[model samples]
Target: MSDVVLGVDIGTSSSKGVLVDPAGKVLASETREHHVDRPHPGWVEMDGGIWWEEFAAISRALVHDGDNVTAVGVSGMGPCVLLTDDGGEPLRPAILYGVDTRATAEIAELTRRFGGDEAILDRCGSALSTQAVGPKLAWVDGHEPDAMAKARRLFMPSSWLVYRLTGSYVLDHHSASQCTPLYDTDARQWYEPWAGDIAPHLDLPPLVWPTDIAGNVTAEAADETGLPEGIPVIAGTIDAWSEAVSVDAQNPGDLMLMYGTTMFLVHTVEQRVSTANLWGTNGAFEGTRSLAGGMATSGGITGWLKELFGSADYPELLLEAGQSGPGAQGLLMLPYFAGERTPIADPDARGVVAGLTLSHGRGDIYRAALEATALGVRHNIESMEAAGGSIERIVAVGGGTQGDLWTQIVSDITGREQLVPSKTIGASYGAAYLAGRAADASCAADAPTGSSVPYAASGPGVDIATWNPPSHTVTPNPGLRQDYDELYDLYRQLYPNTQAVQHTLARRQHRLSNATDTRSTA
Candidate 1:
């Protein structure tokens, strides 16, 4: 049997695992779907136990009793805050990434305390937004003192898996960078003063590169997962960075566009580019930097539309959407159902469907939803470019990339061609590659030092370009560009045009929801 590596990723809506050989052929794959828990508005969370449970299940289902799986790799949806006790019991449900907007007050308080948005951005490479882990930590300290008292350690999904599997507490530098104010992007270490202020009692893990060998799976973990007793495990980064690795879009000017429950954009830059509009942080590998932008909703709007339409499936919707043509037949949507993240970090922002008419059909609405996501992508790209991001190429990945209509709309709106890779297996595949690279290096006695890549089949090391290359390019239609440009202008204006109304309704929604919950309890 060929040596293989098992890669598992704990995602937002599911956990996915893939077994791959040294040559990157996927041997087996498994998925277990799950969802986040929202007990209150602006609060999205998941039981931390679910992450480990899913990982163990996926491992057992993928690796056989006697399979020669040389290594294990892990990735997850993060910069999450999972506060655990000394013995590793979760104190509370893991506060998820940016979508969980419960930290708004904490964000403002910290921003003011840290000398302002520019100061924090200059030091931490990201502003104190919902995305920054520091604000979330402060929120916990202020709100959940009972949990905070018992919180002896902190862990994200990947780090949590690494701790469970190898008994080694470590977090990748890339993921650490996302813990803004808690980590110094230049120093690549925990920023002591701010970390002390935010999570004083928590024992932070050692920082390692995503490709570094975290440790070997212990005998206890082996018993649970049915893998080799001492197989190596590579430290993994966040899902988006791993997705970038999967497509070999880590070089400067390479912008990775991830479309899923949420839309994420990672633009790798040559030098550090800090901006309040976008997230600036260290890359997956050393000496690399990225300006990242995330939307709280993308496919989320389309999914909601599908559920509302009830009769039409994705394929049918895609067909009708394509037929509806550019500009969505005089329909426009804001795709801010969950609130906006990058560029405009407003949690009160609500979804807006403009240009609605009795004449418009479901197909036109669906097409408008698709176009809304595309326009958001354009907005993020524009923000990135304005902040000194050189986006020369866009590589599209994720579940949204499975269908062509979405990508086509994005290209048509942005007037930029997008390259889709052969194997868009995403974060899990990237984790597997890192696992393979680590296993190869461990096997070789003469591996070189320095860069993450070593023992490459060609070039310097295990490059993703060798494993997966662009299968096709989605080119923009020149004719649609003029129409899209007009709509894009309106899309940008619609938010500020109706910001006060959105916020007013958002506040009323909170009051109504609270009353409903109180009555339900009574």
Candidate 2:
């Protein structure tokens, strides 16, 4: 039997699993679609139980009889707060990353307690915001007493899967660094004082590099999922970092743009580059650092617009949007339907569509949505450079890269060519690569007795370039430089100009939602 590694990633809307041979050939891929539970505005969550269930089902589906699954790799959306009781059962639905804006009050409280945003940023690499795991822990302590009382373990989606598959409570350093005040980026260890302050009762998991062997599949888990018992499991990381690894974009000056439910930008840096708005953290492997940013929406806005357009599918809309041309027929939209993150961490920032006229059709609106995300990407890229990071190459991944329209607009708007890899199965594919590395017998043989080997060891000798090289490039349309420059300027000004009104309307939305809930109970 040929040795095959399994990779799975838990995402916002679905779980995807892929099987890959050591030669980088994808044998099979499986997807399980699921939805996040949004019980209240600004709150996004999911039952941790769903993660394990989806992972197990995907594993079973991918691993048939006679398949020699050598190793397992996992990744997921993160910096999430999934607390469990001492016995390892989840206490409540996990509080998701930056999109869940319910932690505003807790963010403010923790910032004050920790001296201020700058102090925390200097030490933690990222400040308190909806993205930080510390504030969410504080939120739980205040709001859900029952869950808090029993909360004794912390797990992100990837870490939770590791625990389920191997009975090892471990989190990747990349994910742990995003935990903000709970971890010190320079020390590469938990900041006990801050962690104790925020999560007094919770016992944090030990950290490992994403490639390190966490543990082998336990007999119990293998029995339930049919994976071979004792196969190694790599300590995987947050999905974006894995996505970076998948395309070999972790080199310094390489920037990865992920277009999915939310837009994510990750830039590899030689050393730590902390920005008040962007996340600065360790990379999946050691000796590399990353400055990361995310927009609350991207394909999300496009998908929502598609549902509104009713009969038109993405292909038809793209054709019409292409005809709408460079300016979106005088329409411009802020891609903050779920609220904005990075460069401007405004949870109350609402999406704004300017220059909308009665004559504007769905195509024009769709074009504006695409342009808005492109502009947002440009905004984050500028912020990254401003923070002392450099970008030499831009790589585009995720489902949005399937069409040239969106990637073209982004390049024309940003004036940077984007390299699209041959296989954009994304984080799952990257996870499999790491798993293949872990499964290399020489990796274990090369390690010192009772000590782990560094990820840079050439024993595995795996190179991602051979697996998913850049198959094509989207070059910028220099003809649109002047037009996009003017548009980008207007985009930068729109948020500040409408800040007051946006906050007022956002508050009114909260009030109306509260009233609706009250009436339902009445």
Candidate 3:
């Protein structure tokens, strides 16, 4: 009787595996790091082979003591577009989620051909943008046709891992929605008519809920992953959605705010929503709807600052930020470090730091970064609210929420209370819970047990007692709120103000990067 369950998370920077018991307790875990190749500026490619290799290494590590694993679940970064042949061999490196933005031309073409702005929104629930799989598929068709021709199937990050595990090609509904013109959330099926015309060469897999049974793990996968040959595999979802599951984001207005390589918010709504500022779609849970917003940079901005200053001690920096007073003394940063995605949907949106002066030090800058991310969150919350999604409470999860300053900043900016999960490892834990449910219904059968261990002041990974409320709740200060209201107005305008400049710079940077790559190959 194998009782242990395994959850594998394929992230932007690394792959993590966690083994857990029925009660949401992590027994053992493993991680394997991987790298992305910047073949050209504005493009990010990672070897799918590296993903599988790392998963194998971590699987061996996770089961070193030989626990009885009943089922395995896989989750990964969202909206990633991968090209693979019928037999599941990679034709080209994966164009990862949010980071790569070389699909501007395709987006324009899509907008022109699909319909005017209003019609496009009505059909796909989002305007054509780099985040949409339709545009990325168009990019491959126009520039990388050989890869596209060879591709008999396309998989998002999570779907790719599940395919390797079960030899079944499937995507959860949440990920499928990002395919934009290809998926119809209302119909709950692939929109073959539009898909055939728009992306005729692309192959889309079957859509299912995140917890649906994809298939039994194959013998080959078992040999590679050190698991039993016939374990059941679930159709896991985008990392953010899985994280929502981990936190029990089930109510009508519950929002899951994930701060990882990017800052993504998924709000569960009782009814369908359509908005110009946010992407709305069917949730992974059956019969539910969702509104999603993403900012292309969150921890990426913080990581950039760390690299610029050459420091590995970020926790200490957070402590230093705690010493600084609110608003970072009027130092406001717009964290568009990786360009903007939601609301404005401008791939060329750039980062901005206003009100910087000689008096400000590293702590002020760090605090400003946190404030910028929170402002982005506030923007998303407003968009969702405008689109008719009620946001009564927010559940904060992911690597970024470990910082008390970050969580409080979001709480203050959004002007809503935040509930930080006791276990911040949202996706990994959600995958584990899926596996546990697959093993036997009795294991954490209730969706979102609301049984969480609260985060202490230490950080994301630090342990604290379960059943406790959030360490501290932040209410928006009226004075700072007035100032931020003004700052956010300026933050909203930054994109339009700099769009033309950013476009020119992005093109130049792309050309230079392509020339360098060509020279290297020569």
Looking at model 2, which ten-residue stretch has the lowest summed lDDT?
A: 444-453
Per-residue alpha-carbon lDDT of candidate 3 for residues 113-203, written as tens digits (9 for 90 to 100): 8776677777777766777888888889899888877877888777887888888888888788878878877787788977887667667
**Model 3 misplacement above 4 A:** 442-479, 514-522
Cα lDDT, model 2, residue 334: 91
Give TM per candidate: 0.96, 0.97, 0.91
Error of 2 at 342 (Å): 0.7
TM-score, structure 2 vs. true:
0.97
Ranking by lDDT: 2, 1, 3
Misplaced by over 4 Å in model 1 are 442-461, 519-522
Residue 310 in candidate 2, Cα distance off native in Å: 1.7
Candidates' C-alpha lDDT: 0.88, 0.90, 0.76
Report the C-alpha lDDT of model 1 over 340-449, residue by residue, as the tens digit: 89989998899999989998898999999889999999999999999998999999999999978899989999999999999998899989888877767544312322
What's the distance in Å from true for residue 188, model 2? 1.0
RMSD of each: 2.2, 1.6, 5.5
lDDT of 3: 0.76
